[model samples]
Target: MVTDTRLYRKVTAQAWDRLDSRPARRTAWLGYDGSLPVIAGTVICLVVQKLPGGGGNKPVEAS
Candidate 1:
């Protein structure tokens, strides 16, 4: 799908604003340092866990 550059930028800016305005306080005690990697890893894990054969077997990669 194609996205318009101007609209994308506007939406991104608004999202950032809302994200920054969120009420939750960031903490370092939970192994999270308010980084994107933590969020990405959480989403990936959730998706993998929901997929069939996710825990049973993994696809072998070719070297």
Candidate 2:
């Protein structure tokens, strides 16, 4: 979980390089400007939905 760890940095750097080198020109419009936020929000929502009592899969009943 420690981002400062060498392994984490290396893996992330490699992934970034691979993604960065893509020939897709849309990256300029999509990277941080659009897709990143949407992707991040999706990830947050999925994480919250998975947490216990986060009301993900079960329905709550009124008393």
Candidate 3:
């Protein structure tokens, strides 16, 4: 469980790192596929996007 959580966080953080190095645009999408903590081997999806005129305030969605 702990390993899964760490891996999930690592994947998410890597996505954010890549996004941060890019130039700002009208829109952008970032997604992560990883395991969940409580559900053991079960996986989940996390998506985030930069909204129009958000000026860097991106919104995140997790499933």
Top model number, TM-score: 3
lDDT, candidate 3, 1-63, per-residue tens: 122342223223222321223224323333423432232232334432432344544445553
Ten contiguous residues with the weakest lDDT in model 3: 11-20
Candidate numbers, best lDDT first, in rank order = 3, 1, 2
- lDDT of each residue in 1-63, candidate 1, tens digit only: 222343222111111121222324455346655543322111111112233333543544321
What's the lDDT for all of these models? 0.29, 0.29, 0.33
Between prediction 2 and prediction 3, which has the larger TM-score? 3
Provide the global lDDT of candidate 2 against the true structure. 0.29
> What TM-score, computed on C-alpha atoms, does each candidate reach?
0.14, 0.15, 0.16
Clashing residue pairs, backbone N/CA/C < 3 A, model 3: none
TM-score of structure candidate 3? 0.16
lDDT of 1 at 11: 18
Which residue pairs collide in model 1, if any?
none
Worst 10 residues of 1 by lDDT: 40-49
Off by over 4 Å in 1: 1-47, 53-55
